[model samples]
Target: MDLKNLHVLQQLMDLSQDCFLVPGPVRMGQPCLNALSTPVMTARGPEFRDVMAHLNSGLRNAFNLAPSEPVRGVQSWSGDDDYKVVVVSGSGTAAMEMVIANRFRSNDLVLVPTNGKFGERVAEMCQRFCNVKHLKYEWGRAFDLYELERQLERGCYESLLICHNETSTGITQDAAAIAEMCARHNTSFILDGITSVGGMPVHPTEWKAEAVVVGAQKCTAGPSGIAAIAINSNFIERVHAIRDQGDSNPNYYLDLVAALKKGGDDQTPWTPAINLAMGWGAALDVLKNESNKVRWDRCETMANGVRNLFLDLGFELLADAEQRSSTVTSILYPEGIDDAWRARLKEEFNTQVIGAQDHLKGKMFRIGSMGETPISEMVEGCKRMIECFTQFGMELPKVDVESYFK
Candidate 1:
């Protein structure tokens, strides 16, 4: 984790290519670099207001929220008031937690699916305030929809919590299917789209999602310390009802009522990381040039190329073919190779892939092709990986980089 060590190590083994293939904080080009040089602006100032509008407009355009979209109750936000985008001063998890704190109390019944780390995290975070019914599944396995329907029939849950893209296991759940299921059961949908939103297509209106959370880092191609929580207009009215009736929430920073009140003026209750917010706005502006479809296609191409590279090298993938994530790809390392194999990727090849989480530690490795990471990096890294793995005694055929560029 030492940057100094990595800096010295990058010049080794004639592997000069540096590919940052972790889930996030992704690489943002010049716009991001330019924002860092800007002085911090007051959250309530006109300059910050314009930047906030720009950032929210990008989200609006990406989600395709227009006059056609049905919005009710929430009308304070600018533009069409289709969706209320709450910019919080924390990592993606902050937005995730905000959804729980704002929507549910101890009396509310929340259903969560546990197939990966993020799903488990949301369930755990919700447990602090509300009743959570955990739907368990084995890691690396695709979600069992039949079982989910069975569970939905078992209880009258207030809201169904789901993570659209579970980064830990590289599985992107089908949102439209889940949304339809929720509609059938008369339940509101809350999605954790931290790894998906900007990198993939997200339909807030079509899916009928109540509130969804995303981070600046992962697919947004920005720095951390900010999480964007989007809530539909209908849900915002319910939030006001909670506050109007004096529903007491002990937490100050995450108090939905206070945040929503401040958000009406394009501001936060507490001082935010202004520089990072500015950088996030810049990132959104950069992404505006190309369509989200193209961005997602680029990510998928790189991901497929990387996955094929490892698969061709005789390494098995962790996720199934149907549910594989376009942003992050996790592959199981063979029996003999330990953590050193991953370390060698950084020190020897100047390429950094993600290490595995609990139970699969040292046995799995992940490569990120999300955000601004281009197909060129995957091609270069895969070729270098073939050479690196050969040194680890796992010899395999080389990848045809030219052919794999989709």
Candidate 2:
């Protein structure tokens, strides 16, 4: 087998032609692509330190944290001291697990509300280190805040973990309301902002989220294999107290304290994917150039455009209308259509979209509105979907696609 020249590789390369609509590992812009190709530099060298500085600042800005000014020689990075932002050489899940590992202990009680795959994952992670109480909902349904409050009113919870955006279901949680609940109860707020941070409104401090995790591959349109966290002083102080009691975090590489200490100096605790950091920093630059508000609005516009396009085609959406996310849109497949439609869309039209996860597989497909994916591309993707559906004996109603985006 000539593995190096596999046809599948060519098929992936063909993606450059146009149309990438998956929920994550989104289409990268030229700037990030150029940054990824830069010659690998020594991770511990001064130049990489500067790279880290820029990356840290970018991540902070995306999280809506106050800007920090670097004080020259003593500490290369010193802004936002109240919040420690750490970048790790792993995916968003690794960052989420790091939070659970460092902050929760066997004796702690945690409340996790699950309505999607990522929400279920947070509960699973918490179960490893703490007593987890799940306010579970059926997939595709929004969480019941009244029920959550009822649970919280019972007291004794040390932390609350939730996903800001449930990518798997294309539902954005009500962070503002949840934040108020967490504050009232005095529970540490941990958020999974993987698909939300850069694409939508994710103000960790404003939401009172003590710990938040973000993925580079999602909203930022950067390469995968890197994730970041934004956490406040309260989280750090609690972790220190836990360490002082001799119950240090089990995983060394993800040890929060060491990571935060090194991060303060614009460095990682271990060898990092330096190229990925450079790429992510470049992608974050694109985010900053547009400004957070405008970027967020664009995402909303894209999401609205995608949703309206699908709905006009007679497709039912998976998420509740009001809770639908600005980053992804999950659409239920029309009767007699299945996952095979996605392949035909890609094979015949050079368009790609994501399939459902878990039990929803084959029953639904998702279209991502995040990153550098152009609205025109998504509109084209929808057109391909229409063509594909027609071949399946389903003729969608004609719609003025331009009106959808507006």
Each candidate: what lDDT? Answer: 0.77, 0.85
Which segments of model 2 are wrong by more than 4 Å? Answer: 1-16, 69-81
* Candidate 2's TM-score: 0.93
Q: What's the CA RMSD for each of the models? A: 4.2, 4.7
* Structure candidate 1, residue pairs in collision: none
Q: Model 1's lDDT to the true fold?
A: 0.77
User: TM-score for each prediction?
Assistant: 0.91, 0.93
Clashes of each: 0, 1
What does candidate 1's lDDT look like per residue over 1-406, in tens digits?
3667545544553566587888988877788879967977777777766666566666554444542121222332335645777788899888888778877756778888867898999999989878899887777677788877887886679888988888888888888898999888878899998998877778888898998888988887888788788888767887777667766344777877787777666667888678887788788766767778788888888887777767776889888788888899998878788779878877767788889898888888888888887777877777666666776787577567657766
Which 10-residue span in candidate 1 carries the lowest summed lDDT? Answer: 67-76
- Model 2 residue 242 CA deviation (Å) reads 0.2
